[model samples]
Target: MTRLDAYLNRIGIARPSELDAAGLLAVQAAHRQAIPFENIDVRLRQAIPTESQAVFDKLVTQRRGGFCFEHNRLLSDMLAAMGMANRVLLARVTFGDPPALPPLTHCLLLVTLPDGQRMIADGGFGGTYCPPLPLADGAEATSGDGARHRLTQIGAPGTLPGEWLLERMGPPETSDGRGRDHAAWEQQYAFELADTAPADLVMGSHFASTHPSARHVNCHVASRVLPDGFVSLLERQFSRYRAGHPVERREVADVAEYRDLLAREIGVDLPVETLDRLPLWAGAD
Candidate 1:
């Protein structure tokens, strides 16, 4: 079978007849739900090549997951193969405590649908929108799985002209009485619609996958979007979430159990030898 066919099978979706917004949403949701966001290769001491074919091989053929660059690059290539127009974009991650500034390290897509409407299609971010978010600033978009997100232009003092911020909107209970609740909506990342070349992503992926200070290099991070909520594995801690329900978390116990959880829960299959080599909390305390 062709790589496209393999990818479609991996995501458990058949090719759609038309590449419209609905079709785009279906594909994006499938990709997010099927291929998890992970950094197992980094922990295994394997080099992650930023090329499209390498990414496809690992994600589709080997049944492995990857970080932003790998996941989004593969999705972008697939969209291109299906005759859709998409531009790769980079963003600086700011979701962490104290926030990461500068050196745009996250990769995503700006796709023009069949009807000429532009949207942001991202399969990499764990807790963001599933269906593509409309590119219009201040316009809200809801994912198929019920997550709400929006985009807004950031102004002044370190923000560039046209720099857009993608924020995740909290549910009603999390909102304060005032309309302007900083705690109500959280900023996922800051990015501009400026063109991002392949080389830019290669450099960004290099730092994200290998740098000692990079967060991915330190922990066993993996996440998958579920029908109701989400499943995530951080270091040895595994957590499951459902909308309107509390987060359920547990310790992974040992390497064998960790490997089993990856294969069974997250849908990633890694060799036993490789799993044995991975350091527990490689860069974390």
Candidate 2:
């Protein structure tokens, strides 16, 4: 089968007759459900190959999960195969109130639909819009997994820059250590509709995957969007959410537990030998 057919099968979706909003949403949700965001290879100290075919082989043929670079590379490539007009954009992931400024290391898509409307296809990120997010500023959309999201422009009035900030409706921080009652818009990431090149993604992935202190390299990270919620594994801690609210949490004890969770919850099945590369997916002791 052609890679496109394989990809559609992998995502458990038939090719959309017309690539419109509904079709895009279906693909986005299915993609997230099937291919989780993960960094096992990076955690294993393997060099992340950023080539399109390499990513396709690992994600589609091998039936594995990967991080932003691998995820969006496959999406952008599939959109091209579908004859959709889309381009890749790099963004700085700011999970709201980041202790330090981050660099642009996230990948997303700017797709011009047939009707001339634009949407952001972020197939990788967790707690993100399930459909391609609408491009209009201040317009809100509900995600497939029950989360809410919207875009806001940057800069002064009438002098809006190309950069767009993405935010999700989440709980407000509380000083009492107990959760607050009100919901607030939290910054997720920001990106510009500027031209991005393939090399840009490769460069970013190289740094993130190779840098000794990078988060992915230091811990176990994986996430899969559920039909009604989400499940994430990070820093040896596993969390499950329902309706965008946390419902469960636990720490993975050993490699066996990690392997089971990776398979049962996150939809990834690594070989025993591969799982041995990281004893506990831990950081500094």
- Our model 1 lands, by Cα RMSD against the true structure, at 4.4
Model 2 Cα lDDT, one tens digit per residue, 202-234: 888887787775556656667887777667777
Which ranges in model 1 have alpha carbons more than 4 Å from their true place?
Answer: 97-100, 127-130, 155-162, 171-183, 244-246, 281-285
Top lDDT: which candidate number?
A: 1
| Model 2 residue 236 lDDT score | 74
Q: Name the TM-score of candidate 2.
A: 0.88
In model 1, what are the clashing residue pairs, if there are any? none
TM-score, every prediction? 0.88, 0.88
Candidate 1, residue 133: the lDDT equals 72
Q: How many clashing pairs per prediction, in order?
A: 0, 0
Off by over 4 Å in 2: 127-130, 156-162, 171-182, 244-246, 279-285
Q: How well is each residue in 237-256 modelled by candidate 1, as lDDT tens digits?
A: 78776676875778987778
Q: In candidate 2, which residue pairs get closer than 3 Å at backbone N, Cα or C atoms, i.e. clash? A: none
lDDT of 1 at 93: 68
